[model samples]
Target: MESAATDNTIWYVLVVLGLIYLIVLYRNKRATRRRKSRRFMEGKRMHDRDN
Candidate 1:
């Protein structure tokens, strides 16, 4: 019975850690996309100015 309880606790911890990892991964992907878009816009503006 005690082993069962410990197993449950471990599963819960693993699920919570997995969720946090996913959230962090999503945020990093979003930030990277935003940075790329911003850089692209800046380059476009510079090219336009040159022309």
Candidate 2:
């Protein structure tokens, strides 16, 4: 019984950790996309300013 309980706890912890990792990964991808978009907009602004 104790072993089963321990196994359940480990599985739960692993699932939670996996979710947290996925969340972080998704946030990082979103942040990078935003940064790229900002950079593109800034470039456009500078191009317009030059013209």
Candidate 3:
């Protein structure tokens, strides 16, 4: 019985950690995409000004 409880706790911790990891991964991806879009917009504006 005690082993079962411990196993459940371990699984809960692992799931929480996995969720946190996923959130961080998603945020990093979004940030990189935003950065790339911003850079692209700036480049486009510069090109427009040149023309």
Candidate 4:
């Protein structure tokens, strides 16, 4: 019974760790994509004004 409880605790810890890893990975990817596109966005802004 104690082993079962320990196993459940480890599983919960693993799940939480995995979720945090995924969240960080997703944010990093989004940031990289934004960084990659920043130049294009800047260029667009420069040309967007017909004034």
Candidate 5:
């Protein structure tokens, strides 16, 4: 019975960790995309100035 409880606790911990990992990945991807878009906008501004 104790082993069963331990297994359940481990499963819960794994699920929580997986969710945290996914959230971190999503935030990182969003940050990278935002950075890329900002860079693109800066380039466009330079092009406009050149024109």
Candidate 6:
């Protein structure tokens, strides 16, 4: 029973850590996507101006 409890605690900690890691990764991806889109828009505007 003691070993089972220890295993459970370890799994719980790992699950929480994994969730946090995924959230950070998701936020970074969203920021990168937003930055790319903004850059694309700026380039398009510049192209229009040149034409």
Residue-wise lDDT of candidate 4 within 1-51, one digit each (tens)?
999999999999999999999999999999999997997888888889754
TM-score of each: 0.97, 0.96, 0.91, 0.75, 0.94, 0.83
Candidate 6 residue-wise lDDT, 1-46, digit = tens: 9999999999999999999999999999999999999999999999
Go through the candidates in order and give the clash count of each.
0, 0, 0, 0, 0, 0
Q: Sum up the clashes in candidate 6.
A: 0
Ranking by TM-score: 1, 2, 5, 3, 6, 4
lDDT tens digits, residues 1-51, model 5?
Answer: 999999999999999999999999999999999999999999999999999
Candidate 3 clash figure, as a count: 0
Stretches of candidate 4 off by over 4 Å are: 42-51
| Residues 1-51, model 2: lDDT tens digits | 899999999999999999999999999999999999999999999999999
Q: After superposition, how far is residue 5 of candidate 5 from its true place, in Å?
A: 0.3
The numbered model that scores best in TM-score is 1
lDDT of 3 by residue, 1-51 (tens): 999999999999999999999999999999999999999999999999999
Q: What is the Cα-based TM-score of model 4?
A: 0.75
- For every candidate, C-alpha RMSD to the true structure in Å: 0.4, 0.5, 0.8, 3.5, 0.6, 1.1
Positional deviation of residue 51's Cα in model 5 after best superposition, in angstroms = 2.2
Q: Which portions of model 1 show Cα errors greater than 4 Å?
A: none
